[model samples]
Target: MPALFPLLRGRVLCSGALGGRKPDARVYARALAQLGARAAHTLFVDDLFVNVRGARAAGLEADTVRDARGLRRVLKRYGLA
Candidate 1:
């Protein structure tokens, strides 16, 4: 992520660091708690469909992205680009 989006450096969360992996709702919950973010206001983007589904199940807005270009498009949709 740092290589693709330098501005996100040190601002990204790692599931492993949160003591869980993608597709595990706990990871997303922990992340939201740490960020003090509301599930409805957050967008979770991942390359895998399962992970995206997991986020949605956790009450977060989610999308599946293939690469940096796709990520850019998704972020743009959310007005974050």
Candidate 2:
């Protein structure tokens, strides 16, 4: 796993499970912070409100999307499209 850390940078890190038993956003947020990123500068997108709320609680801006169209809309709103 240590060998894969470097390769994971700049990638979208997500929990493998669809719902239960997944690592929460707080964990990833803290890891990113330790990697020298400010939570406020990070944007977390998830389909679930619980996950979105979790990310927000971790100090990151978060959005909940219902589908790919919603995701595109968010990206456009952020000028990331």
Candidate 3:
């Protein structure tokens, strides 16, 4: 993943690493804490609506994208592409 998106290197989080799963606000909190990031400044992207909603409920800007193209589109919309 890092080879394709260098900016993601050392910045990916999984359920195990965060000790929680999707749709859980605690998971988002843990991830933000680990990254030293503010929820308002973060853009959380997931393919599942439940996860995206969870992010939003946790006070983050969230989006859902099912493919790389969709992901790119969302990133572009946010000026991160």
lDDT of model number 2:
0.67
Q: Which parts of model 1 have CA positions greater than 4 angstroms off?
A: 1-10
Task: Rank candidates by TM-score, best first.
Answer: 3, 1, 2
Indicate the worst ten consecutive residues by lDDT in candidate 1.
1-10
| Residue-by-residue lDDT tens digits, candidate 1, 10-76 | 5579999999999999999999998888999989988899999999999999999999889889988
Descending-lDDT candidate ranking: 1, 3, 2
Between prediction 1 and prediction 3, the one with superior TM-score is 3
The alpha-carbon lDDT assigned to residue 58 of candidate 2 equals 76
Clashes of each: 0, 0, 0
Please write out the lDDT profile of model 2 over residues 1-81, one tens digit for every residue.
Answer: 345357557555545422323237557555565567788777778788887788788787779998878977886787666
Q: What is the C-alpha RMSD of each candidate to the true structure, in Å?
A: 2.5, 7.0, 1.8
| Runs off by more than 4 Å, candidate 3 | 1-4
User: At residue 47, what lDDT does model 3 achieve?
Assistant: 95
Task: Give RMSD (Å) of candidate 3 vs. truth.
Answer: 1.8
